[model samples]
Target chain A: MNTNNSGHSVDIVEVTKTFANVTAVHKVSLNIRKGEFMTLLGPSGCGKTTLLNMVAGFETQTSGAIRIDGKDISDVPPFMRETGMVFQSYALFPHMNVFDNIAFGLRMRKLPAKEIKAEVERALDMMKLSGMEGRRVRQLSGGQQQRIALARAIVIRPKVLLLDEPLSALDKNLRLQMQVELKELHQKTGLTTIFVTHDQGEALSLSDRVVVMSRGEVQQVSAPIELYTQPANGFVASFIGEINALPKARCQKSGQDFRFEVCPEISLNGRQPARLELKDGQMVHIFIRPEHIEIAGPRHNGANIVKGNVAAHIYQGTHTQTRVNVPGIGLVELRTKGAAAIDQAPLGSEIALSVPLDEAVILPA
Target chain B: MWRQTLFWVIVSCILFYMTIPAIVVVMTSFNPGEILSFPPNGFSLRWYEKALTYPDFRGAFRTGLIVALISSTLALVIGTSFAFLVVRYVFPGKNLLEGILSSPLIIPHFTTGFGFLLLGAHLNLNQTLTIIIMTHVVLVLPFVARAVYVSLLNIDPNFERSAANLGASPFMVLSRITVPLIIPGMAGGWLVASILSLTEFSASLYVTASRTQTLPVAMYNYIREYTDPTVAAVSALLIIATMLILMAANHFLGLRKILAIDSH
Candidate 1:
């Protein structure tokens, strides 16, 4: 909203990218505010990386424009774009030591030797890699190499930092560690970052605003919580996290609530979304999170309750995922924190489940 | 255990059979007499002295060194540029160009030499160093280019894009990133080309003049002239030199990388 933020904003206007025969990215328009960590979240072949490459000037858009800080860089080459991209492989120059790798950009700019040294030192210090300057990239561990790659990119003070699945190469623990470092790095340098990742959990944890994409189209763009709680359509709901998609059901309108009738004769009184104008028997899809499906207790006669036999129990360290097979409603999964659900809902035992859609995403089938 | 032992014995025997000729040549270089005999009666350095001092041998060595240096350098430049073109771009006649350029590796050496000889004669370059050097370059080009091409393929393309993203011009990215990474391949290719050029005989016989003859051609001519150990002495020295060069290259560049051999 302010001039300071607008000064560094990136405005992508109807950007479309195509390969020889395939349209990789459809017309996607989004505005990224300054200093915001915006992430493009999608599955593989969803055009997130292609979109990032277009912004970085590695690939030019077939149509439309990409403006970085209000300057259209469609005709500008990659080197002149002033955008720093950390590649998926880290792409550290294997021939050079860490010092030279970090100083490469400065050398390309023909900076004075003294200033270059100071800048390299500051960057190394910032990444907590001050002593690793003389080490070969092959000698360093994966996490260390990742930090050095970041140091190399940020040392240039690029207009916008583009991260192309940089954390995807690391192990789970290292990935978590780097995610924190990435968040802190974003805060420290206030560089508007456009991150592309297929990991939905990472997208949820990292981004200030998440753009959910599917099949080269932007499905929804909102805050991570809003993306989960209020998905614009069916694709965004199924993508953002673990969700149990209920089978097609006819909607029966009550005064304020809507009842979804299934063959098993279970009434579902869920909040009717404004986008869906329901007649008497209009089919609608119901999506509920694994955590939302709770086990029914005694003295529970709710309309959304259904009976299903527990099919499987997968005990994760933090939470247990239970798969329930309902005859007419198909299979629905439930998540319960800790190992309680594994014993509470025994396999092959009939258990009543309360499928709540009060806070869930309900869309037209 | 018996079968394994027998298999290894047979393998060693076959290897020894293949190496017997080289061993005989090396042993004959130390023979004191004019005619070579197995397990020489007396060791002498006279043949080596004679081989090193002979005017034709000396001249041929000098000419071979010049031809190897110039031809290998030319091959490295042409081969690397060809590799860059073939690997980076797809155009009309790409396959045809590749096939024609790499044909020397498959075509009979004498045929290629004869073709070059005729071409040189047409150009009024007969019996000249230029003709010999041109033949050597053409013969060794496929090897050098293949090495550089493998190196280029192994290079992550992101290295260049990353360099470009960091404010490097197209030339700067190439000079700083791409060139440095492929130096080992270039060195390996140059070494192989030079060694091959120095020792090439079949092709040199057709293209090289008497004055511009390489070491291998001169040795062949000497063999036809007299039954002496002088050619044997020269062959021994060349074998040792080649072994040393290969050992040095392996130590420095990990020849497996240049050869595109996976260790596992």
Candidate 2:
């Protein structure tokens, strides 16, 4: 990885925030590299926005410190912190025209009139809003207003650009379009960005590193692929995507592989993970994505085959999700490619499903 | 259709009943005769000319305008700060403070006038512009506070955060964002308070020793002492001035837009 080492890096150390009797953030520590796109992903009321606000200096942390570059900014006010933010509501000044809204920061800095006009024009051009400099904000659509909000923030060339779910107001198609534009904008400016969102798809797609937060603590901080493939815990796994969880499985080590008895008449062999230690007769749960399960032939030769009947077949646009009911084991959902599973595995038909050892993840029950 | 017709009839009747006295007074201002009468003998500008040139009437009109201007301006400032405190902060006695500030609007005007009369004498502040302006501010501050508070509530709180993050200091955010957005409400408050102060009579009558009577008080005293068309002419001019002020205010800040605070 080529990490840029020469820009503003935010270091949040053991920060805890509380509002009256409720603790919003608890001892959260994170390091965002210079010029890296870091995302805080969580549900509502999970303190993601609170953490972003603390970094932007809108809310002071109850305890601990936040540093930008090598200097501590705990005492600095928001205006002095030199961080630009796009709010969730896209809070553009309704009284000002597009040019004045984007030129506000430059005017606040007391820049020369020529410089202010030049900078504002450049920002407008960059945001594809060059001809809209004279338009009132109230006349703009939601997408146009969103672009103006970004233009206003980026015109200042702040040390770190903070976005608080700036795309949440757009429609689905517009949201996808803006998501692509946001990634391109990040690459073009190469500014350190901290984004807060509740959408896991947005976090996984736009961020260099994703921080999954639950309640008031960070559950895991990893790359998108690592978070999807090797989640740190049950919360991270379920939050990132769908998975079939087989709890109450007993495991026994056999050489390099471990045999797991998932349920009555359903014994399966799997390789033990190198990082996790296991003992004989230990209770564990196995998680596998529905797409990883495959249909085995009647005379299957693999040691992972199990006999079950196709209970249901749900036809999605690009794929079919089939639920197979094993006599001893519970219903196992399998995703098969487009319209194929319906003809092959009709309802109430006997079928053989195979669970590959490498695709299954074993966790302590 | 019958209900609609009856509604229109009743509305027009009420309107005519409310406006006939003012129409009669305006018509008397144009009376050619010296005595004030509903139907004039002939049209003339003699009474308007006399009323404009009258020294006491001129002095009273000037005093009323100046006092209203200074007092309403002060009331706007104080009421806006009070609104900020009530909307944005939490502290002891907040509700109590609001209740006390709004007491003048609830209490009888004559009772308030008598109360201020005793206070002014005790403080040796009678017959002074300071006391008059102070009293007018106290009387009209509730209107300003209510209008400004409604506007403040309608403003999205994120706008301030966005400004702060864009490198604006607290004072700059206030001057650049908060104040400009609420100016419509402030203008509404100023106009209502100033008009009310200009027409104030009971409070000024009780407080003014000799030199500081408002226009309404001077008009009342003049009508009691003598009978002529001069007073009607003065009333006509005051009405025209008020109409002009309303037009100017509407031109600057839409009157309907400012009063639409409750809808927001």
Candidate 3:
């Protein structure tokens, strides 16, 4: 047995998976760095989980190759792939207790009893389940069962660890706690983890790099902050966070600067007419974060200012959200910190709105 | 509440109806009078001793045990493999294959016996123990296959896939995971098949040789040739033996587990 201190990277090359007439995953090529926590993030039926299964050799690629440590393993069965997978449902052996669950892989490898006991105990300790060695998996809480699953997978000391929506079954608080534990566990073990989840927040929070996919195709692959700040397209941006999308017809451009054409009925200073060249006559979307738009101050010269009536105002304890009705623009949301006064800003009251041009993102038609 | 009451009433009626004949058989077997009768003057163990001394009775009992054991074991092996194929693999004419395997259950036993007799004649296997065993296996195969197949279908294929992914070979998954999980269903099917083979009469009548006369066939011949209380005694003994075997099976492997598999 080769006991090398350095870990190996997983390289998936143009892998595609098709079941009968339906294609689950299209040609997806991605190189996961050694010891990096990479998440495949997409909605249901987006093939993110399928991609993870292909890496683990649970599902074979219809076409293309997969390699671990730079050697082709597309034809290798799951048992010979040396990859550990934690399923979404945990899939712990119902007949086995915590100790046996963790020791199963070691036993399969025919390791000595003393060594298996030591490894199982160490795994239980790593998962903070030291004294839970004898408990049946069904008896454990959801979070504890999830930890047992992790312990079972990691105890095998696999070169690659594949997690398919591991935290999805846990309650929100436990999910968050496991997220931190998983990150720390990955850092300590450096096992080249490949995780799959539909939740963008999970991907952004836990991954070293996030691969965003849609309709069985990869949209973008980048660091979490880059994916958040500099999204490759509208799909990634909308899926990642809430954004107010407005028609680009309501926006004008000057050299490199752009402005919105607020309703003509509403009076505003320093507002320019939308540029003809920028308006392709087709509907284009402009996304602005709710926090980027502010209630204008009197006597302040603000760019892109709109005079509108408050259609509705909701006080949300920490922040107050108001929907202002501009004549042609319908309703635009404005979020402000610090609770607004209970008697302040009644519905249909006139107010001036200002949005910084830099904060608005122009999306393709 | 009314429905539950009605269900219990019907169940009690059916249970009473089924037990009446068994009660008569036991009562008649212990009759003090020389003749088998519904109401006995007094109880005695003389008929049991007389039934034991008869060579034909002892030989037939031994034959039934051998046939039932061999046939049930053979059926279990074949039926379980058929179930595994139907559950795990996709092939052409799968539905047709399933129908053929399960067809024995629908066919009349007399027709099956006559067909087997013809086949045995063609194969020069007339009146042989091998022929009787083979026919018995065929008679009970559908029950075993259907029971085990249903259990295999209810199990998630992902369990096996998950096992394979965790470094278990296909054989390892079958032996360690799949087989252990399905053993309850297999045992239930095997028990039913064994009981069926033990009491088999119509097929055994045609296929069994003089040296291989099973208990049921031997009892039929004894009743036809001689009108005596010894036949009732032997019938009672067979029923008691069957109940003992069933109790032993239930004690070792839970009846609840087997019934649960059938329910699913």
Off by over 4 Å in 3: A1-6, A248-251, A261-283, A293-327, A330-357, B1-7, B39-46, B49-53, B226-235, B248-264
C-alpha lDDT score of every prediction, in listed order: 0.88, 0.88, 0.81
* Chain B global fold similarity (TM-score) for predicted model 3 against the true chain B: 0.90
lDDT of 2 at A327: 78
Model 1, residue B55: what's the lDDT? 89
lDDT of 1 by residue, B1-264 (tens): 999999999999999999999999999899999986777778999999998899888999999999999999999999999999999999999999899788997898998789988998899998999989999999999999998998889888898999999999999989988887777788899999989998998989998878888899899999998897999999998999899988877865764443222211
Q: For residue B220, what is the lDDT in candidate 3?
A: 92
Q: Tens digits of per-residue lDDT for model 2 on B77-190?
A: 999999999999999999998998799978877777777888889999878888888889899999999889988999888888889989899999999999988888898889
lDDT for position A23 in model 1: 92
Q: 1 or 3: which has the higher lDDT?
A: 1
lDDT of 1: 0.88
Q: Model 2 - which docking category?
A: acceptable
Q: What would the per-residue lDDT of candidate 2 be over residues A258-325, giving only the tens digit for each residue? A: 88888778888887764578888899878888998888865667788888899999999899999998
Query: In the order shown, what is each candidate's alpha-carbon RMSD?
Result: 2.6, 3.8, 4.1
* DockQ score, prediction 3: 0.39
Winner of 1 and 2 under TM-score: 1
Q: Write one digit per residue (lDDT tens) for candidate 1, span A88-192.
A: 899888878899999999999999999999999999998999888888787788899899999999888888889999999999999999999999888778888
Docking class of 1: medium
